[model samples]
Target chain A: MNSRSWFRLKQNAPKLSMLAYMVLFFIFLLGPILIVVAISFTETEYVAFPPKGFSLRWYERFFEYDAFVDSFIVSVELAIATAVLGVGLGVPAALAVTRGHVPFANTIMTFLLSPLSMPLIVMGFALLFYLSALGFGVSFLSLLIAHTVISLPYVVRTVAGVYRGISPDFEESAAVLGANRLQIFWNITLPMIKPGIFAGMLFAMLISIDNLPISFFFGSADTNTLPVVMLSYLEHQFDPSIAAASCIQLIVAVIGLFIVERIYGLDAMTPAS
Target chain B: MILKRSGITTVSAGVVSPWWIAFTGLFLVVFFVLPIVNNLLNTTELATLAKQRPISFYYHKLFTDPYYIRIVFDTVALSVGVTVICIIIGYPVAMFLVRHSGKWSGFIIFLLIAPLLTSIIMRTFGWRVLFARRGLVNDFLIWADILEKPFMFLNSASSAVVGLVHVLVPFMVLSIASVLRSIDLQLEESARILGASRVKTFLKVTFPLSLDGIGTGFIIVFLLANGSFVTLLLLGGGDLKTLPLLIYQQFTISRDFQFAAAMSNVLLAIAVGCLYLQLRLIRRKGVKGS
Candidate 1:
């Protein structure tokens, strides 16, 4: 080959390597999950990959247990309650931080978001100790409060981000139209930041459902969240049933993301850098 | 509340109040701050066990105990290792996402986001399955004649690191990508037009420009890794014991409330230190960018 063509080929080499590396990274990210979903369909008694002779038996077995069903319902309940609490507290706080001339607004914002930096295990211990001290004990109520503490930051961050993007023009114009403060907020501000509010609530729900350490610490006999139950069960057993349950969770999360993407876009929902 | 007869701008200024801040602030204080503060205060009980003892009792135990010291060392070492590995792997994927655009980029991003949204417990379980004896990884290695016998893969420090990197790589990627996307491509173009090669331009321009993101991502992954428990518990296989695991044991298995409270305070201090540094870095970056 000519020297010119050789140089051109060399130029393409780095691009080719980058493409190859990207493919490998994708595989690394998705391979385990695809394996788990595949293993859940195994006809074998144990968890196997390239899963032996596909069967729906494990999924059937997962549904047969009332414990799994109850644990799942409890998790759902906790997530919903956490989302409600998060939004109720988060939206107004977002407004206060973004619009209100509160002293030390930056510090207050940091305090609201501080839990994101905390180790869940540490938070779990603190919550457990504090609740016991207050006579709350380990119960669903304590679990809900702990989950809310963990999830509230998502709502605050997402809504504040969206609110910051919105100019005060609409609210000002509404005020000029002789609308009162509450009316201006409900009529002008709320609708403008609805997408952010929705994104925050969805994220809060997802975080609450996926949480493990707090639930493990605060849950009682009848209050085991799904992750807590699956974890404790996995300690003793290795079977396709756990895989089946994981698939259910996988589907739920995927559905949540897809809905958020459709409505507000995934990039908007991701953690701000 | 009616504003005095003033213009619209004045009315708008009067609308905001500190009372709104109190609503969420109170909720956070009661639920979030109070719990942790209560835990910290409980450490004082360590001094009065049976009678008026010294406050240094639990603190002395934590510092003097070889097991606790080892746990702290392991936690820091594991977190550092995972942070290094994540940045190595995550930087390229992030670059690919930022430089490339199309259906493939969307699909790749979905692949990235899906795992992040899924439960950490579920993802760790997948690793547990993969690293099990006679699992896929073992089976593949054996089939390829790489191993003479099935080696135990789960519960090692390596397994815990692998699990943590998997769990946290997305955070690294997202943080870096967010900053990478904000970087001006024109700077790279200008560098190239000024007679620099692609590699040199990226090395001198793009990489330098993305350092803030790198710092942010590193801090995030480091914090999460330090605080992580589920991955270590599930994958650290019995061999790995982290500070979080020790705290859990202290609180639950041993039921040493005061000592556990003391340990929790130390862990909190470490985590909060990192967090404080991170917030400062981000604030400085914001100032420089604007």
Candidate 2:
């Protein structure tokens, strides 16, 4: 009886512990996320989690609000534009850092990646002064360029890491087979690193969408991204609408992340992060 | 190997030397260096303004002022408290993930890192909803009859710190876990084999191995916690003020750009110094290890 009872305990212990931890961690982390998701579908005028009298009322109201919709389009446009611009700059830089034997390459790589180091407010303040002086004063392109600058490091780091996975010998062998540089890149390099590029683009899009502090500086009434709009709204009116807007941005970001994970394993992209 | 100069040299046909230099160099000049210099130039009036405003007066106001100085200390103390709590809570979770998680590691990682996919604002909203007086947390506590009256979690210092800790814990865990996993499992096994208890083996072997990760994680948690705005602003509810919020208020509410700039510099100094010191130490240690 003693031996049998001991055996039963041994088999159940670790698995039981894992289940317990999973439940607790899920409650602590995913609990909050689930709450926000539930509230997004609420019928209540104010924010509610374990949402009361469930309906799509808030979603409908969000659509009805012209300013919210306008900011929503701006955010989407900014995210797309940032992805393109950031990727365009970051890919070349990543290629250079990985493939080319540039001088002080380590320093260059670190410099490109330094935005990860600074506090957002300092970056915001500095950008505000710089943009104002340059007469880029809250224009769409100014916001576009600023967002691209911050997002560039993510693309560079991710792309460089992805580039590292491409065998150096593959490039050499392609050259030996009389493939030109362009042909080698097109046929071999591009196809291999497509996952990295996509990952970087996804990261750029989400980060640009979520960013508020820098957007606050460069964003005007017209150029304001969704986060900027939400921040301004929160400052003026502390309401469920701000909460509603926050949920929308998070959902969009999670969707973007989900798609990126589908295309490229999420592991492949986080090097930039 | 033949020294035959093939017309298509490997890297020659790849990236033009000038283009790489020009592109990265130009990009850095415009984006990084230019803004810093511009900010410096624009903030030239700070020193003059400080001189005009009596030195003792500023000191008396800042030092003796409970409203301003108390918040500074409160912010610092709360962030430090949260960092400690994160390390205490997160280290074990991270250790469990690395040592015991095995095949479920990827899924567990997904669970941990997925929160970061959402915006900070959204997460704060969720916290506000959950922690409000009439919210789920209070309701649960009240239903359990832990208190006759609902606990005041919203717009409180404790709530702000808890939110920051929750957000920062992932960074601490991930940073430590990644470093911890690289530590040879055999090292811990050897200690156990030599008659060290599990606790002893961890203290003697595993803990030392993960020290760099712990330190890096601590520095990251501390610096970011110091600079955080959204959590303080959203959850702090005008009762508590952090440095970033003060910088914001100075500019937006007070319209004192000079004071805001000075405040910004003070905050920037903390961030930049922490980052610099951590990187230098890491670099030195990395060199030694290599």
Candidate 3:
């Protein structure tokens, strides 16, 4: 190599190695999921890596299983309800704290977002006994309440983050034009924070659907979520069907993420630092 | 009420109706605050219902019992181990993501986040597939002549740790990258112009500045790892019994809600302590930034 080329190669060496490390890191991050996907196509009764032959039998089995199918429907319904409730409760509170000039806004915001830091298992355990004591028992209502509490933070944080960014001048101008408080919110504020509300709702749904620890406490014949069902299934059986179920859940997640990426951008979805 | 400020007549001042705050606060107080209070109350009620000793009995057993003590030690150790691993492996990637990932930043962020969006159970299932006796890891090891027979990687403490690090490294990376992105590159350039080597500049200036990010990442990973039970339950094979795992058993098998409540309170204390430190760090950072 020429001396100039040699100097260039030395300059690029660290970058190239870092690139190499990044590739390895991606593989580590993604390898297991890929393996799960691969095994979902396995013809074997057991989960095989090379996956003896490419077949969709496990997928068929997943659909054919009543418990899996039922729980999946329950999870979807629960997630939808959670998203709605979380937004309803979270957005207005975020608005109150951010724009209402509430006293101790910082402390109130921290309290609202505190659920994000709490251990899910502890929260689930507490809710289980607490709700039972309140005569709610282990039912879907209790489950929804538990899910809403955990997901409320995402809705509040994202909406508050976005709302804080928006200049209050839009609302001020709207108010000056003789618009009422509701009109100012509806015509001026709501449209601006729609993306934040959308993102937060999606997060709430995603968190509710993917939750395991919380769902574990509330699982019954009627209330078992897909994750709860899948856990029980895995404990008793090790089969490729579980892989199929996992891949299906993964597909749902990807679709949700894809929508967020197309609209809000994934980079912007990072919780406020 | 109309408020006039800075020669402007503002009728509403954009103040949200107090009803919004009231409704949300009521919901939280009933559903969130009460449950925790109820959990605390359960600890006391166990003395009456189960004919057990007072609430102190459970706490005493947790701290005094050798088995419980060992589990507590293991839980903290596991959390510490996971946090250290995440930082060691995650910092470089965070640096690359912040400083070097120009065109690929979007795709890289997607890749980082996609795993997080996926259910923890699904991710753990992926590890299960890989660590199976006849799985890829065993196959690769045997094929590479690293062993004569397939070694069981499943259902062990080491496996649990590996699973956790894989699940949590993204959080660490994201936390550090967010902070790293905020750090001015000119500072590093100035250090270089001052005749400091690249390594010296990073160690002296960049590393010191990034401590807040590391601290944030540390607390987050530690808290998450500390609460994590699904990964342990799925991969731990009943060998590694952390408080969460024990609590899980209490609810599922033993039906000891009282003891479980007590254990979770301990877990809650640790999580709350970590969160307090994290909030303080963030507030301090915010103060410095402003």
Candidate 4:
């Protein structure tokens, strides 16, 4: 066969294999997501797949139930707190590492990312013991501290990547024009890194809210996040309500991830995925 | 010289040193040292917990016992089983995603990643529903007479592995896809031009180049599958107990914090050590190859 035919052979793959892969992945990833969405609309008595009938029952059940609503509110509050705390701890650290000219900068940065690489279960138990011994006793602040720890890496990495993208000349120019270090940062560096910071916050919030094992230890009945709440519901029985709660969180998570991925570009995220 | 010294002094005094130091200090304290300290605390608890009864018996059973060792082996076997399964299943999908271009590539990429957006709880909930006794999956199979009746999919260990593979296959696909993206398509084309058949060209040129991606993907999926709690906790359906879920159970339901901590510390150490070794080995190999 000529080279053209052989090239045709290579090109033939996309149409066939790509379509097959796309279908398989779509079903694999979104199949369950779609199931949850459908189950939320499910009018059945029990959690049913290819949900028997469509109604607003599950979603209605969620809002009508105060515990679920409280957990939802708690999740939102935790996510917001996590975002704020993470950015607070992360941005300065990111700036220092990226532009800090600190000795062993790379070594330090890797240490920051170590938490992300470590098993989260240990951290959760650690926080539980540490907070309990200190008399925090699974309180809101304790959860926030632990969540903030996990969230910090996202903020640091995102903003650091952003800082790397920007040339230092802009800051230097501001410095040359009579800006002090604080003014230079406020006027120039901060704004330049804002998108990264925003993306980082979004990522951090998702990590905080979606967290399972850690939340299990830190969450109390009143303080429970949605995942923790859902876990309790699941441990009890198979019902559409837990699925409803999951659907709600899943929608929010998708939107949150989309916004972050749009701003930061999933490609920009350390290639860790 | 004075101006330069002032600039340097100002940087060290006001901005640079403090930033790095603060970040390094915070990162070290929060992530690195604290978890290490915490894990050590868990490991130290094993002996202290020996007096606790059945849970304590469970610990001794796990440590000084035979059944516990078998469970540990089973856990590793399941993770490896699914890890290998995922690589087999995911590589073709990733390869195909890289082959498509233009609007198609954009569309395919979205489809591939969109599932990842959904909450794990939601995804697992969906899986549980479908795999339930009379759920859609069983309905289809039963209607088609693929099974005499709805065979148990939700409660079985095989089902648990399948659920995990479903959740984790995306990680593998994306990892391989990223590697494939970096692969020069021209090499495959050149191989074709040199008269290697399509199969031969792929086996010789494309597959070898994609090894790093596969390795990355395998490492990630294996680690995740190993450390996974929810998928096992929910889908394992009381039949399976992996290290993470077992750790959680020991601390919560059993109230054996010390033994839980020991097991968790061991698991964490194993995970981190394996990851570090994998990366170092890969880096060394990469350096040698280059």
lDDT of 1 by residue, B171-274 (tens): 88988898898999899999999999988998999999888878888888998888887788789865888778777676657866676667778888889889
Model 3 ranges off by over 4 Å: A1-8, B1-12, B43-51
For TM-score, the strongest prediction is 3
Evaluate model 3: give its TM-score: 0.96
Error of 4 at B163 (Å): 1.4
User: B1-290, model 3: which lDDT tens digit per residue?
Assistant: 34434324444444466557778888999999888877877743444666465667889999999999999999999999999999999999999999999998988988899888777777888898788787778888999999789777888987899899999999899989998998998999999999999999999999999998899889889989999998899987777999999999998998877888899999999999988997899799889989
Q: Candidate 3 iRMS, in Å?
A: 2.2
**Candidate 4: residue A1 Cα off by (Å):** 24
By lDDT, the candidates rank as 3, 1, 4, 2
User: What lDDT would each prediction earn against the true structure?
Assistant: 0.83, 0.76, 0.87, 0.76
- Model 3 lDDT tens row, A31-145: 9888888888998877677789888898999999999999999999999999999999999999999888677888888889888888899999998877877789899999999
Q: TM-score for the first chain of model 1? A: 0.95
Q: How much is the lDDT of residue B144 in candidate 4? A: 93
Model 4 misplaced regions, further than 4 Å:
A1-14, A268-273, B1-15, B18-24, B27-32, B42-63, B285-290
**Cα displacement (Å) at residue B49, model 3:** 5.2
Which stretches of model 1 miss by more than 4 angstroms? A1-10, B1-5, B14-16, B43-55, B143-145
Fnat for model 4 comes to 0.44
The most accurate candidate by DockQ is 3
lDDT, candidate 4, equals: 0.76
Q: What ranges in model 2 sit over 4 Å off? A: A1-19, A177-183, A235-244, A268-273, B1-3, B6-21, B41-72
Instruction: List, for all models, the DockQ compared with the true complex.
Output: 0.61, 0.48, 0.63, 0.47
What is the C-alpha lDDT profile of model 2 across B1-290, one tens digit per residue? 24324534644545323255457657768977687665555443444544455334544565578886886677677768888888887887888888788898878888877888777777787888889889889999899999788899988877888788878888788778878888998898899999999789989999988887788788778877887888888887666787788877776677666556556655777777877877686687779789
Task: List the lowest-lDDT window of 10 residues for candidate 4 chain A.
Answer: A264-273
* Fnat for every candidate: 0.63, 0.38, 0.62, 0.44
Positional deviation of B211 in candidate 4, in angstroms?
1.9
